[model samples]
Target: MESPERARLDAFFRHVTEQFPAGAPVTSLIVTHLLSERPAFLRAMSATSAVAAVLPKPRSIDQHTLEAVQSLYPVHDLSRELFADSTRALDYIEETAGGQDLVLADIGGYFAPSLSTLVEKFSGRVLGVVEDTENGHQRYAALDQLRCPVISVARSPLKDCEDHLVGRSIVFSADALVRARGDILTSRNACVLGFGKVGRAIAQTLRAHDLRVTVFDKDPVRRVQAHAHGFRTAATTTEAVRDAELVLCATGNLALRQDDFAALRNGAYLASVTSSEDELELTPLQDLYQRVPVGEQLTRYEITGHYFYVLADGGAVNFVHGAAVGTYIHLVQAEILAATAALSHGRFEPGLHSMPAADRQAIARIWLGHFER
Candidate 1:
């Protein structure tokens, strides 16, 4: 007998297939990280005549999974073959598409010149894209020219899955940090840069761990929100880090630069909760300061005679150190799948778009029904 959750997922997939018929041929080029663990997503794509090629992040590829993916479709590890060489990746995608209607991808496909190239070359053949990351959405929105619809989970008002999932994961990361660092977070002052969804969540998680949390965001509205939430707000990033024993960057944008390192208190642990080194400007920091590796994922930097520790090499602390949020990510993936189906049905216009409210509600309902039980 099919489990209730499995039945619901099957019904959803069937509904999508009915709405977007295979006769129209909705071929897709999916680029993402951690594809192996999400078997349901892969199964849905396999059922569709639309799946053309899958490009997964190299770090996410395991030997067992790589074999499985290769047996189903042409699988390319994006980090190894594509990310470093977008032009080559584009060439591979163009060839694999082979005149089929191409649609849908994650952040790995939507960033930089790659998306522009797909839009230009594929034209009407390109239906839409699904971007889940804030940085990717910002990049796509800034493009002066866009040919297909863009559905962003990051920007969706109705789909609070990202926010909720990130919030839960932040607590996990905090727990791992506390365990590893000998209760440094216990009753200590921590600053969270960027008062966005992820930042606010990190602050809340820290507080739950008995840490005094302060938030810093350039946007006044977010700062006010943080203040209203009873968390202290810092006027500037520099001010936030100066006295903080722990600093977490959650702004999708670069929140800390090499110069900002000078402001951090000695022995302060700097970590990122958004996307990796981008939020903390790791390249410049490494160039400007003497770096000593504490472990595979943590580093110590000496600047101005003060020592500061960087968690996960300034990468996402939860992903690098703590357990993967598998269940939460599966929920987000369902939203992505729904958006892809909606796009295939030609329900959106040629611009950046949010996930349809109806879809968000449905996904949320199903998710809540499963978890609430």
Candidate 2:
């Protein structure tokens, strides 16, 4: 009997193939963190038989797992540094692709300084890029004269599902933290920075856990929405950090800086639910604190007569600590595959574009039907 995960993977692939015929010859480049949860996607893409190269995130997954997946498809594991070093990444792409067109990437590919240059150098040979993160979506907005169409999953309505998963993961991470460090979350004052979908979900979850939650967002509209939702809204980041025992940064932007760190009360715990480490601005704190390992996923710092705790080294706490999003990622992955099909078979104008609503609905319907049963 097929496993449930395999069954769902097959169903998702069938759905994509129905919309866009598979086996159409194309060359593609994929840059993403290679987690144990990614094999399903690798299998789905292999079914298309696209000539592909992968630049997995540095040290994200073990070489044994990568080797197993590579055996199933003609995938070249470009150097791990490729994702961080854009010039090297682009050079490898140029050499490996040898004129193949489609590019699919997560945060790294979207924010690479050489992206615009790659599109220009490849010219009409490139189909376009499919970006899957909020940080990438923000970076896409700043690019001037993008040469090819950009399909952004971050902008799609399907992101609500992703945010919901993030909220669930945050709760799981919070529970783990409580178990690791007792009584920190029980009726304690906590602040969540940002009122975006992820942040809103987190605030709700934290409140559900009986933590007094205060939400802070730079946008007045979001602040008003938080108030409407019956959550206290902080006027400034400083206000949110002051006296809060727990803080979560979900803004996907730099929400905390040097001064904000200075405001943290002793024994305060900070974690980033965002994809990057920019959430807490730790550069200036490097010299001020003596780092001590608390656990595999946490660090304790002695700074200025107080102890500060950071979860997952100021990165996505749930992910770094092995709290899997599990099947919630299936729908998001389906959306990505559907977007890839659309970009391969359809034409798109340059600039950021949401996944077609019809495609989004179709993907959602499949997952909803399965879960609803």
Highest TM-score against the true fold, candidate: 2
Name the regions of candidate 1 deviating beyond 4 angstroms: 1-23, 58-67, 79-89, 157-159, 181-183, 321-328, 368-372
TM-scores across all candidates? 0.86, 0.89
In order, what lDDT does every prediction score?
Answer: 0.70, 0.71
Worst 10 residues of 2 by lDDT: 103-112
Per-residue lDDT tens digits of candidate 1, residues 276-360?
5458767766667899886555678986788888876665666653335544555566667777777767888988888766766
Give one digit per residue, the lDDT tens place, for model 2 in 193-297. Answer: 988888899989988889899999999999999999999988999888887888889887688987778788898888887544447688687898888988767
For model 1, give the 10-residue run with minimal summed lDDT: 15-24
Which portions of model 2 show Cα errors greater than 4 Å?
1-4, 22-24, 49-51, 58-67, 73-86, 108-111, 321-323, 368-371
User: Looking at candidate 2, what is the lDDT of residue 371?
Assistant: 57
